[model samples]
Target: MTWNILVGGQDRLDAIASVIRREQPDVLALQELKGWSARRARDFAGQVGMHAHLAPSVFGQPVAVLSRRAPARTRSITWRLHHAAAVATVGGLTVVSTHLNPFDPERRRREATWLSACFFRTRQKVLIAGDLNSLDPGTDHSEAVKRIAPRYQRRHLRPDGSVDTRAIQAMAAAGFVDVGRGIGPTVPTEGLRQDEFGDFRLDYLMASPPLAKLARYVSVRRDEVTDMASDHYPVVASFG
Candidate 1:
């Protein structure tokens, strides 16, 4: 499962912890973890009986991974502003937790290329999950995007009149599949009244072929608790 918890709001973290306890995912990926130190993340993981690896803060935003077993390795991949990937290996799978640049499509494309390269470099099954900040142009999220923020179209649309999907395409070209691509929107419209876009599908769980085959189900978690916890919703993917 993966979620961007709104800059790690203390109450939000508590809420996330509660959800984690209930869901008990094998691995949890987190982004936009502002104000969360390694110790704090570790403490939280301990409370939930998991092991945590948090990237060093970059302008207060860091990515984190928590799993039932300790990861064989943990590292951070830095790119443009407020964009990075927190990576770890657990149960023979490479798990990446990332948050891409929210406003720059071109930069996002570059970041995606790098991220995909990382996945291809390893032979282990890989799960690349996070807030990609880019949408698939082939999918019909137009109405949802319009309802959130009409102005969003002006910023995200390419000159050719397509939503910038290079980043997503990059991953697909590298043999990764977005398990939640058409599942549902991951962001909620309520808190987005002040933003450029309302509820949209911004978070994702993309995996290599091996991992994709292992996925049994994937969906967005939308309940009173998740809705009130953060602007974005949590995406869960189950593997057998």
Candidate 2:
């Protein structure tokens, strides 16, 4: 599972815990963990019945991975990224939780390439999930997209002024399959940042070919609990 949790869920930990308890995912990747400290993370993990592995902060906001079992190994990617990518090896699978630069596509493009070189191309059993904040080539143009400010929209435009999808396009070219591809939109739950993005599928769970093949299903959470928890919805993937 992966979710942005909207600026640390605006202090709504109980609602967040409620959703996680109901879903019972083996592992959950979380982004936008603003104002979180090691002690807070440990306490939250205890509340959710999981073990946490954290990343270094970018302006006090980091990313994290919570799993049912302890990680065998862990690492972080902080260079050239908005929020550090939290990595953990648990149950023999390498899990990467990341949140890319939401305001810059060129940087996102570079981040995507760098991430591919480091992880996707290795043919390892890996799961990369989080708020990519980059649109795919074939997704629909929603009504919400038109509401964004022209300046912010300009950031996502290609040189020719079309919507630039190069970031995610680069990842697919580097050999990762978007495991959450056909799943519904994962953003704009409630109280979303109006100037940022449309109601699109910005969050993702990209898996290596082998791991993707083993994935049985994927789901996006909606409804009362999710809306109460964050501005973006939670996405879950299952492999047997």
Candidate 3:
């Protein structure tokens, strides 16, 4: 599961915990973990009955990965990203919790490319999940994106007034497959919709071709707790 829990879920920790406890995904990738200390993240992991790793970030927007088993290794990746990404090696799979620049498409492009190529030294199956802040190809979010008030749309579009897609394209070129593509949009939960944001997919769970082929199912989890817990919803992808 991958979710951008707004501002570290400070005010809604219980609600967030409730949703997580109910879903019970084997692995969780989280973004926008603002004000999160390693201790705080560990405590949250304990609360959820999972082992956790918090990738420390200079900007306070750290990404995290929590899993059923303790990871063998954990590392931080900050290659031109607005937020630090967390990597955990669990079993034979390498999981990456990533968050790209929320505003700059060019920076997001660079970040995506770097992340896509990072773990290729080994033939390890890789699963990347979190708020990529970009849309995949073959999905038309233009209508919803355009509804987000002109001034607030620059970051989501090119100067040509079209949705900018270079960031995601870069990742695809590196051989990453969108495991949850066409599942659904992942943002602007029921109570959080505003003029500045509309329904669209900004979060994802991507896998290397080897891992992608084993994916069994993908879903977007939404309900009362999710609506109030964060502006962005959670997504889950299953594999054999």
Assess each prediction's global lDDT (C-alpha) against the native: 0.79, 0.82, 0.84
- Going through the candidates in the order shown, the clash numbers are 1, 0, 0
Q: TM-score of predicted model 1? A: 0.91
**Which candidate leads in lDDT?**
3
Instruction: Please rank every candidate by lDDT, starting with the best.
Output: 3, 2, 1
**Better structure of 2 and 3 per lDDT:** 3
lDDT per residue as tens, model 3, 162-193: 88887778877888888887888788899777
At residue 173, candidate 3 shows an lDDT of 83
Error of 1 at 200 (Å): 1.3
State the lDDT of candidate 1 residue by residue for 23-48, as single tens digits: 89889999887777889889988998
Tell me which of candidates 1 and 2 scores higher on TM-score.
Answer: 2
Give the worst 10-residue stretch by lDDT in candidate 3. 115-124
Report model 2's TM-score to 2 decimal places: 0.94
Indicate whether candidate 1 or candidate 2 has the larger lDDT.
2
lDDT of 2 by residue, 1-240 (tens): 898887876668788888899999889999998887767777898898999987867543689999999999989777778788999999769999999878778888898888877887455688889988888877755344556777778656777767777888888999898888778778777644355666678898888887988999998988877876887899988897
**What TM-score fits each model?**
0.91, 0.94, 0.95
Error of 2 at 7 (Å): 1.2
Top model by TM-score, which number?
3
Cα deviation in Å at residue 14, candidate 1? Answer: 2.1
